[model samples]
Target: MNKLWGFIVAYFLRWFPHGLEPGLRRIGNPGPESPVLVSGNFSLTLKRLIRSLVGQDLWLLVANSRGINVWCAAVGGMFTHHNVIAAIKTSGLADQVRHREVILPQLCAAGMDVKAIREEAGFQVRFGPVRAEDLPAYLAQGKKKTDAMSRFRFDLRHRLDMLLSNNTMFYLIVAIPLAIFWPHRLLAFTLLFWAAAFYLYLLFPYLPGKTGWSRSLYSALAVVLAIPAADFFRAGQPFLHYGWMIAVVLVFSTVGFDAAGILAAMPSDAEAFLHRLGIKRLGSLLQEKTLGRVALDREKCRGDMICYSICPVGVFGELDPDKKITLPWQNACFACGACVKQCPHDALSLQPRP
Candidate 1:
């Protein structure tokens, strides 16, 4: 029963807040024979990966990536060397696993520098296939990845998962409210929103050549046309009512805002749309005085810029001639913890605002 509820929660998180990571299987004792595999902590991905390794015996190291799935966290630069190190240290990997080596997911390579992790953490890193399903065959054939294992795929099931994750918040917070308050008019509007969400989710990959702007505009226009038609068809009484028109506009506009978040190519595009709709401000907020400070233990730093370069907000500055990293624009820190992931010495990290 507990496991059943956990899976339900995991399914919902596929489109809402992130899910838990799967557990690791320590293959062999402290020896050269044991192969240690690393992966993200996304509950769904972890489950899929572990399920793939059912027949094999291996050590799986699950990194803490804020519950985000592997590819997303890697591209976002969250699952880097420091994070791997932190996981290793906290998990007591050194004492448990005899070999000083770790196998990483190939998809995560972009976010990590193999040489850096090897040098700083004293562990050799090996990259495995893009998907976990191929691991058993790859391992059987002298631990190698076949061409099939290296490929990345995005099929119907994958698209639907993304669709659900993107609009879970919308269905819960927005859809439910409208349905409860204005059941009659909102009923048609709600149906239209789900139809649009599902349609866009499925059709997005094949859409004609266009930018996010063009796509969003087309979607907005479609919502504008369809909701009114839907309302008229649903209502039998006097159709051209002013209140009805207002409700239609409200519903369409809300759907547009939701679409921007789901469909925008860049986070900035979503921000712009939300701002235009007066949904919320787009800029990141920090308690100005509290956020800019990075506590650096100079004595502890090994001159690793894991935190220096991976900053999405450009908060970390360039390395000095003496090789010391400087954060001249420390005020820019949103405190996202990118540096903490890169710092091998565990020297640089965010301190709570006093």
Candidate 2:
């Protein structure tokens, strides 16, 4: 009965026309002696991780992370000491767990200060495997992660889930039109979904292009060109009539391109390429940090918090009564140039890091 309800909920969530966000789960509880595992409350991560640990007798200490996954939330600074401490205190985790330790994903180290967490809260943070699947093995083997467990891999199965599950809205809406008008369209759509899914998932690393976008555009163009040729030979018709097929090919192919951002693995190949390009440009611009620092001269800052508001990284802090604001934690800047754009007086300059 419980499994049935869970399936229903998952399906309803997939079909529902709403944006995905993380939230806390009020789930079944385990005894104090049961090991407590910590994770972000991102709905997708929590649901899948909990599903993976279905048979285990454990307590999940889901920290409120504003719906971000563990690694992302940590790096983005939303899943911080305040959130962890607040979760522990507010969730009454002390009363539910016998041990003074909680297992957290290793990737979370970037955002979280483990030492601070320990000092503020008595609970010692235990680093687990990078992926949640290693939890059972690590837990069984007395809390040690094997090197194999820590390494990240974007296998075919992971890609399929991300591509299909993340943009389920696209599928569902497309399906309705096909079902009503193009009754024979369902099979073609399915094949297109899985084929592009497999290609993006399995062949993305080897795809013959620089960026995922470039790869996608070229691949799409090739298919678009070939479809008319195929149609010409099949129906003995001109390419003009089959222009719709080219549109179809382009649409599906570019969907995979867009999926690269959200579906691909961390430090995603697509993102990595962009990062590499950005790093090169920044390195050239800074000239070894010899220029002025990229900072707010408080005298020039109007307490408008434009830098704080426009930063994609959530790096800037609110202005205090003393007209002071803070930058990201040391060395945490991604150098996206958003702050520089937001500065009205050109006060925020990209100075070399000292």
- Top candidate on lDDT is 1
Candidate 2 steric clashes = 5
Candidate 2 ranges with C-alpha deviation above 4 Å: 1-34, 51-58, 75-78, 95-99, 173-194, 231-238, 262-354
Question: Could you tell me which residue pairs clash in candidate 1?
Answer: 15-165, 21-41, 30-98, 82-341, 306-342, 307-339
lDDT of 2 by residue, 1-354 (tens): 955644433443332211133323333556767777778766656777887786787877777766556555554455666677777777777766678887776656545655667888878876677677778888899986655665445566666665555445556667688888987977777676556655665676677665557666666667677777877888876586465566556555545544444444211333344444554221101111112225667767777665554443345666777776766542334443445644656666555456
Please state the error at residue 151 of candidate 1 in Å. 4.3
> What TM-score fits each model?
0.62, 0.60
Error of 2 at 350 (Å): 14
Pairs with backbone N, CA or C atoms under 3 Å apart (clashes), candidate 2: 22-67, 74-111, 289-352, 292-351, 294-351
Give lDDT tens digits, candidate 1, residues 204-245. 556542443455456555646665577678784334454545
Cα RMSD (Å) between model 2 and the true structure?
12.0
Q: What TM-score should be assigned to candidate 2? A: 0.60
lDDT of each: 0.60, 0.59
